[model samples]
Target: MQKGGPPPGRSSTTRRASPRCSAGTSRLRRVCQLRGLASAVGSCSSPASKRPCRGRPESLACRRHGRSSVDGRHRGCMEPPATVGHVLALYPLDRPRAVGAFDASTRNDNLRVVDAGGRQFVLRRYRRNRDPERVRFQVRFQRHLEAYRFPSASAVEARTADPVVVDEEGFPWTLFEFVDGEHFDFSRPEQAREAGRRLAEFHDVADRFVGAATASLLEDDVRRFVATPRAVVDELRDAFGIPSLELELQNFRRRLETIAASLHPERLDALPAGWLHNDYHGRNMLFRDDAMVALLDFDKLERGPRASDIVRGVLSFARERRGSRVLRPVFARGFLAGYRERRGISAEELAAMPALAELAFAPYAAICRMLQADHQDPVAHILGDLQGMRETEAQCAALRQILV
Candidate 1:
């Protein structure tokens, strides 16, 4: 929850490779110089060596073959071609074309590409440490949305029919279609209003979908800090130099625990259980011109309170400077309007909004700080905007009055 490097004991750097040399003659020794695996030769030195030499050799021999080499290594072991079908086979796509490629952060292992057919997809090599059940849950969530006609992207294809794909090197990979549209900008009042409305619509329908019973979007965060609230409080104390932060964190923790406890077990047990898109922030909501086109990023879909989705949307609105004021009411009105037109909100559920809003903020703030730390940059952008939120207290107060 605190802003800093990887949790203490973790190393950020990758492991270094060790080398073993074969019993040699002088030719292979000189050939070893050509091995140059550690260097930038784009090829590893033949693991086998015959003799020793000084300068790099032009004719790089293959480790497998004793002497002659063709095309730098061997014609028999030519590299495979990179093609859309290959990507589709690994991660199924309904239809695909390679449009352009871009880089994903080092944190993820995948090659990102905006397909020519106007879809964004990622080509990932397989990795072992991934959870297959989680991947299946995510894919199933997408399918559930599609089945319900919800405004979300569909996972049309995957390389491995199995939800998890482990590549030759034990790396994992999957492709997702890009949901095209700009992220909703909080600076725009109209956009914020629309985002709110769309989110409300999403939540209203999403209520009927099954979500995982044990899953809570905040589970990871809660577990991480449950036993160490003081550590987080101390981190905030260092950052903000505020005497009240410790108490504030303790109070926040109590509120979270109460909310977690108050969740109706019987109601939750009876409700449909499936998937919920856990990350439903502004960036995940795509827009075209003035209208919200699609919501992307299903990486966080899990099981929990349906209200959590609406709460997340509202919190995202609250975090936006200009949008915080106008969007929430507009979204509330629109969402309630839409939900009522379909299924109605209970009085109890309606009354829970304010508390939900309060409960949502702490996790949200912690996430922003964690992201800033992970990126190794000051969260000037987020902090400045949040400061703007503080400045708009009067406006928010007025909106709350109007909504209540």
Candidate 2:
């Protein structure tokens, strides 16, 4: 819905997509495969037609809890091809044609992938509530990472050379050079080590890039999770039709409080504090074989206790999904080994790993609770994440062994 020309500091291009181009077809097909809808791609009509593609398809990328039917009941709404072409026309590129575009969005932000000149770039239409200043900080952070030769997306500067641009629709959009790699596969121990090593590198860079714009350590999240009222949990259970959800909620509250109490903030106050990729997880990374080719997403970037960042990654990359509902420890040893190879963890930080690992469980619980009231996707897919965290004794023991 971006309406106008380039922002104040940018130049503008106006080349548009051809009404019907063979190049468009190839792009569309690739996008379909990426979205895990090869079947739907077969019957997709022309972009000029403004018709919806028909198929019952789902995406493992977003891992959204929605059912896709022929009736258009589920799935994020796909953007029109012309709209995509229009957006691309604004940016300076050798080939302005938008061969194919797909909605690679999340619950809050809108992301569309546009293939041009045999390369991919992401156009992110940030949520209305997202702070522009913070987003600019993220843009600078990525540039800093790239400057240090870190594998990260390059934010395409506008004509004015500014990394971010405001579209005519008053929404902020930024284009990032796409990295061609797969999400981190935990089954590969080497990949786990590579991820850990790269993460240490990222931390090293972030440690020096401190500023007043960045918020302080990650206390708000812990406080918010602990403060999740029992009343809210009771209502969530009833709305989601879960019978014993309240009891589960009660248990989470107690455990989170215990962890918070045991891991005092003052002990980690002297630990490295700087900008952090608070949501460092597998889905945000790209791997070419066992090596990490790109690290993605920085929307939640903020100054935080550094060890908590590692703990967050361990919870994400080291856990293995068993069956449909359980996430067990299988890779933490390799991950910790790799991390310690590059960065030093203090005694205080090592002691707090177990607690921070417990704290990491809150987001899964919080996300499931928020989605419980929605009738959209099946709640099981989201709530099932919580089930994986229940095997805590084993996970805590695994963490102790790694930190010891």
Model 1, position 257, has a per-residue lDDT of 48
List runs of model 1 lying over 4 Å from the truth: 1-111, 114-120, 123-129, 167-171, 187-194, 204-275, 318-341, 363-402
lDDT of each: 0.44, 0.57
TM-score for candidate 1, please give it.
0.53
Candidate 1 clashes: the total is 33
The worst-scoring run of ten residues by lDDT in candidate 2 lies at 2-11
Tens digits of per-residue lDDT for model 1, 1-404 = 00111222322212222233222212222222233211111123333452221222444343332333322222212111122234445554444533222222222333334434555654443222244455566666666666767666555454345655544433344565555566666656566567656655666565676656333222234222333444644554455434534455455455444544544334334433333465666666667777877676555565545554554565565453534434456544543454355445555554444444443334334434544433323244334433443434334454455345
* lDDT score for residue 213 of model 2: 58
Candidate 1 has its poorest 10 consecutive residues by lDDT at 1-10
Choose the strongest candidate by TM-score: 2
Candidate 2 per-residue lDDT, tens place, 120-238, comes to: 66766554223556667878888789888988888887676666666444445677776666776757878877878888999988776756554422223543443443443454455
Show model 2 residue runs off by greater than 4 Å.
1-76, 100-117, 127-130, 165-171, 213-220, 223-245, 268-271, 321-330, 364-385
